[model samples]
Target: MRKRLLTEVEGVVAAPVERVWRALLDDRPAYEMTTELGDHTVAYQGGWWYRGEWSVTAHPEGARVVLRVYNVADRLGWGVPLANRFFVGFGARTRQTFAEGLTALGERLGCPSRLLP
Candidate 1:
């Protein structure tokens, strides 16, 4: 079985993209925000990628802002493997983590907190 999770976060900042970008890309606030969001650390392993075994993507265009996250977790099961897989496939924990994490980030960035549809 294969499943994909997609989450989008969008907002507007009173400041310009450059200012917002600095606040985001610069280590100080970003690190603080990560910890506040329960993230252990935030690192850029590749272009436009934040590595902490967790992900958050920022797309800042003018005063508009967007963040997208894609998370994949493998759940391998033993003993009644099929049923266990199904149980893990549709669970609330991962969903809740994504929602809360994104909302907290948005709030930290001075954006209205919301869950994108």
Candidate 2:
């Protein structure tokens, strides 16, 4: 079976929900956000792949921009194998990396970003 992992990130945007929603739904900005380093690739409902290393699917629920990211890097390639293994396997490092990616995605979507404490 595929490793099933799903996460939800919620935040309040200073702008109106519709405005924020439009910004996120725009193809160009959405594409840019995913292709940028450290940002996951967001393949829209029926969009094509090839923008980024990983795949992402975006859905808007009212004011919330809910994204599902797939094929995230456990360990980026071309590095010290041992070190990469240690870090990626560690819970703290993994969580931090994922959090950072989510924060970046939120910022690109014009939302103030924060990690849940």
Put down candidate 2 lDDT per residue, 75-100, tens digits, no spaces.
44223333346656543554566467
Q: After aligning candidate 1 to the native by TM-score, how far in Å is the CA of 43 from where it should be?
A: 8.7
Global lDDT of each candidate: 0.41, 0.41
Error of 1 at 108 (Å): 8.6
TM-score against native, each model: 0.34, 0.33
Best by TM-score: 1
- Residue 39 displacement (Å), model 2: 23
Supply the global lDDT for candidate 2: 0.41
Which 10-residue window in model 1 sums to the lowest lDDT? 44-53
